[model samples]
Target: MTVNPGHTFARIAIVTVSDRASGGQYEDLSGPAVEQWLRRAVAQPCEFVRRIVPDGVESVRNALLQLCDKDDIDLVLTTGGTGPAPRDLTVEATHQVLTKELPGFGELMRRVSLEQVPTAILSRQTAGVRGRSLIINLPGKPASIGICLAAVFPAVPYCLELIGARKMAEALPDSGA
Candidate 1:
């Protein structure tokens, strides 16, 4: 499968996992940051679905599954719950629902973040695929989202194509040239 650049808009889901944010104790900057970055980077038209959930493995897992399986979201970006803290279960929850893991996204995110903070090594941000959707876990900080998104977005369009959202017209070529 190949995604045409002219294909219809993609549906994106943004999930913010923070007990304080979910409880109204603090505003969610991370979710908006993700949305803002998507707006700037994605050339294709897109719709964003936002959610703020508590920091728990089940909550994160359920939200991700629902977005991919039920909402038919093309991409799901999560913020917060990616650190070494006790409540940081985003990586684990993501691991549970993903059909395939994309370790390079996490590696590149940390690599880019390391330029600003040594603590970047402690973050557990990750990415994976569930059905037709691609899910990426990002740190809570707005700065980190920009760094990670720049590092990994080069592959997003191609990945979306491989997942069957669009098509290419190239004739079949021999596997071994």
Candidate 2:
């Protein structure tokens, strides 16, 4: 995975797992919210790919596989389908494709969300590594997206570097030129 691709930029894929969003019952706000947050937090240029999938194991799992395996995305962020409901299956789908499970990401997100809402305990957010890509499951609400992301995003760049997703120094343009 040549994450740098001769430039200091990142390719991020946002997958929104929601039946309502996918079925056009409502607009996909959560996906856009994640994109907005990343654009503000990340310094480097970013190319974003967005997808909406219904809430199910197969739908979420297939989307994740395509993004992680075929899209060459450096980071994949999924919103929705992490709750305790019967339809919630983002965590399970994510687990199916991950080579390494990073439990800390979910723990930190739940802990931070718990501070804002007691029901946060029901959220089952998780994160893991698939090949060179890092995939994270986040709560569905647009309001909660920023809170959870802020809690975990500080480590994202470092995690990506550790996973060989990108090298900070290599990604930088040569100043001597």
Give the local distance difference test score of model 1: 0.84
Q: Quick one: how many clashes does candidate 1 have? A: 0
Which sections of candidate 1 miss by over 4 Å?
1-7, 166-177
lDDT of 1 by residue, 42-153 (tens): 6546778999999999999999989888776788999999998998998999999999999999999999999989999999988988888889998999988888887787
Candidate 2 ranges beyond 4 A from true positions: 1-8, 167-177
- Each model's TM-score? 0.88, 0.91
Q: Which candidate is the best by TM-score?
A: 2
For candidate 1, the per-residue lDDT at 135 reads: 91
